[model samples]
Target: MGKSPSVGVLHEDDCDEVKFFEKPRKNLQSDDENVDGRPGWLPDGWIMEVYCDDDGTIYRYYICPLSGTTFTTKSEVLDYLFSEMDQCFLESKNHAVGSNLTRTHEWLPKGWLVEIRAGGDNMDKMYKFYVYPPNRVRLFSKDDVLIYIKEMKISGFDTDGQCNTNTQENILAILEFNPEGLPQGWVKEVVFRKTNTGKIRRDRHYTDPIKNYVFHTKRSAALYVETGKVTIRAFVQKTSVHEMYSFEKFTHLHESLWKRLELGGTNQLRTRLSKLRKLSLKEEILSDEQGSTSAEDCNSDNSDTAHGAGQNKVSHLASTTVKRPRGRPPKQGNARK
Candidate 1:
């Protein structure tokens, strides 16, 4: 059996240096009330907080704007963002990515993240981080969209209360925004809006694709042609057709159009409106095509028709000229006076 090696006792001079001499004190101040309406236990640097009245749900939000990544204090959001970034870093980890790449220190709490920049020329481009099963932001998170609706209300832009809540959420994706992300005016050739019950109920409108005119039905589309106004009485029977009005000096590109309407429930009206829109669009296209052809294709045979029936009447008049005097010989009657 090997003899155990003797351990030597060291004096204070022989001991290794200890960098931290005393235990560190903990920060108990973080437990105080948070004015941001978040849980007191959650760490700081949460920029936005959300609540749901339906389920009494609360969501705390943090975002990395450079990567367009949002975190929900859930380990998963953070884990995904870091994993993707780290994977990119493994490929080409260059330190001097860009001078202009900004790092936000004040906005984030300690240990969440340090300054994140594009590591190299290859990675400087945005690494879009998407949240699975996106929450309300997936549908309606833009401030400009909400502001646009409010302005439309102030300007008296009214719609049939058919648009449900889901359709309005879709509309939020369509409302115009300037380059700076401020709401402008309504840009959709047709739009759906929220109603009293906060559910859009029906097909709000039909649109003339050619004129970009909004109306109530396929009949109303042509009604504009008949009366210079589109008064669709699909909902009301006695109201007069009114002229549509719009705001000026707003630039709304067609790129912002919503792909589909999100009907809250009972999509029967939506299906009918879609069929009507297709039929109306085809009719408009046919009319435009036929208008030019009908004018240019006049029959040339009509030019050969003669007007000699007057001469035959003149030949017959001589036989009846034996005192065909008219007006009852007024001069003879006047002699009584």
Candidate 2:
């Protein structure tokens, strides 16, 4: 059997060095937090803290902008990150691929952050980052845009209707930043305008002094800002023609319109309206064709009489009439006698 190798003896200084190398630096105050040695920077509206456990698990806790608090393990954070920074990295892998694209919004677990260049001549004045899903950051003017650069899912824009909880998590984020942040208006007017649009009815009779309209309907309806006033048009059609008022002219046709609007007017109510208008135009065309056809038939009959067929029929009718008028006079004379 081979003899075991002799173990080397270590000095006190060597022992100290071995112990120091084995011991991790307890950075209670330093920026480096995790295994990746990434420095942590917490944004103004967020709260970041570490959770450590004996089983070698470390969790990063985030206060969600909406619900107030959120937490994920370090492994989970790594899973969600898109990029690796000096001290921190993105949770998703595809984040770096879309760094050059604009209007590309990133989806975080709790909310989303979209980087936007403010509109017009002053391009560099400031780039705006709008956060959503839970929109925790209430940004002041002077903050660095990169402070909130966390991992986000780079998905499409939010073109759907106004979001409630039912909307997709990422979609809600983009919708929150539409028009590069909500337009400057009262919340009421903005919502009202959004909900109304093509759903509102237009008054065809009056071209001048256009009137404003306000309206609503069951389940699905539209309201609009028109003629400096709000107009609403609702309709649902299945069988018998029925229409309802923009404000009060409720009827069969209106119900049909509303129903059609609800089922089909997801993002393009105008397209739906265009289809309906086309149908109306088609009906008008059919009516005009029938009228013209009838007029042409009548004219043809009249002209035929002037030529031969009508005259021949008239002659035959006269021959069959014989002396009916004279026979009536003779019969009356016989009765008198």
TM-score of model 1 relative to the true fold? 0.16
lDDT by residue for model 1 (4-28), tens: 9999876886554332332121112
lDDT of each: 0.34, 0.34
Error of 1 at 198 (Å): 54
* Clash pairs for candidate 1: 162-201, 162-202, 163-200, 164-199, 164-200, 165-199, 165-200
TM-score of each candidate structure, all chains considered together: 0.16, 0.22
Residue runs of model 1 more than 4 Å from their true location after superposition = 1-46, 84-337
lDDT of 2: 0.34
Candidate 2 residue-wise lDDT, 1-337, digit = tens: 9999999999987988887865564444222555444334443544566666786556557552322325454443443232222111121113223322211322322233332222123211212334443535433121222344433333333312222223121110121211211111101101111133434332211111111111232111111211123334532223211011111101122222233334223457677788999999999999999999999999999887777976788899998985644443456767889
* Candidate 2 lDDT score at position 77: 40
